[model samples]
Target: MTATHTYDVAVSWIGDRGTGTSGYRAYDRAHDVDAPGRPTIAGSADPAFRGDPARWNPEQLLVASVSQCHLLWYLHLCSAAGVVVTAYADAAVGTMVETADGGGHFTEVLLRPRVTVSEPGMVAAAVALHAAAHEKCFIANSVNFPVRHAPTVTAGA
Candidate 1:
């Protein structure tokens, strides 16, 4: 499988240089995201990095990939089961820790998907569908980390 993205950097303004004083702009094979004062991960000295707490982080991206996969699969499953789902939303989170090898690597990630469904008596079906989705999720199947589904359901009015 293959994927691609691109980025560029014209200029930036940032001061001070320390061990944890650097920032990154997601880039492609062609360009880079300026430097220092430019947009970057949170916890950086730059004010721009501090905004949008809900923005997807690297780990969060992993979680979202799985959550979205499950959601899509669930939709298909519901349709097959004659259930009409109006909307689905998930508040997913991923956890990262230093690898046991001592490098700055994530050892594991947990995906928590809180899904909302429409119609009565669909909660149980949604839960079962989520399980099936996890089994068939391409990302979950490819990753070695544990992907768990903690689902919460509510009936629509």
Candidate 2:
């Protein structure tokens, strides 16, 4: 049998403005996402939907999840392959198109990862691991949109 995993979180809306959602723009879109032994994440709709800009949105979270998944897998593969990564950062961007029916879907997400390796010879190996990591990323596999990577690897010393 294949291994199985389950994730659970509770979402509580705290946007009631006394009168509640009586009309458009009547209430805030603020909410909280909580899981066991983890800090609560403040969440809201995208600012286009009258959500607070300071809070995390579902679309942004989706992109973050994909980026994080790839990062973790890349690091693990690098460690096992003796690539000796010194640093890694990704500036991931996602684009979505809004429909006339007031719905939207992501078009694509670009993962721009900059990586530093301990040795010059490891640069190529580090760069190659991104493709392998992308293939193993669960979040990327689940999303319908294209998840592209623009990775740059350099030797740190």
Candidate 3:
């Protein structure tokens, strides 16, 4: 049997410069994302869209969600499979293409995870688990674009 889960977030626009969007350039593309019992996440559009470069953007957050989901699942699988992970890091990249009409969609996301394991003998299994983890990632499975994995494993010192 399948179980269902629900998630909620509240996004409030804080970009109004008093005039309330009289023109495209009149307002800042800034907002805040809030969830119960969690810290508020400051968000904005990508800098290319006249948003603040210092604040987190929706595209960056989406990519980060995908990466974070995979990492969590990968760690859980590693623990269950007896693969001791000493360190884990990922440089994930996503590509989005904009249409002529000013709309865009992500084409793909590449997860480059560099993992350090407790033993050299566990390298193969550690690398192999990334595919399984990707298969199990809820964010990756839900996305319309492809989510590819390029994992590297090394023995820890």
Among residues 3 or more apart in sequence or in different chains, the pairs in candidate 3 whose N, CA or C atoms overlap within 3 Å are none
- How high is each candidate's TM-score? 0.59, 0.97, 0.98
- Residue 142, candidate 1: Cα error in Å is 0.7
Q: Write the per-residue lDDT of candidate 3 for residues 44-136, one digit (tens) a residue.
A: 999999999989999999999999999999999999999999999999999999999999999999999999999999999999999999999
Candidate 1 lDDT by residue in tens digits, 59-114: 55567677788778878888899767776777766655655685444455555556
Sequence-dependent TM-score of model 3? 0.98
Relative to the true structure, how large is the alpha-carbon lDDT of every model?
0.61, 0.95, 0.96
| Model 1, residue pairs in steric clash | none
Q: Kindly state the number of residue pairs that clash in model 2.
A: 0
By lDDT, the better pick of 1 and 2 is 2
Model 1, position 15, has a per-residue lDDT of: 25
Report, for all candidates in order, the number of backbone clashes: 0, 0, 0
- Give the Cα error of residue 114 in candidate 3, in Å: 0.7
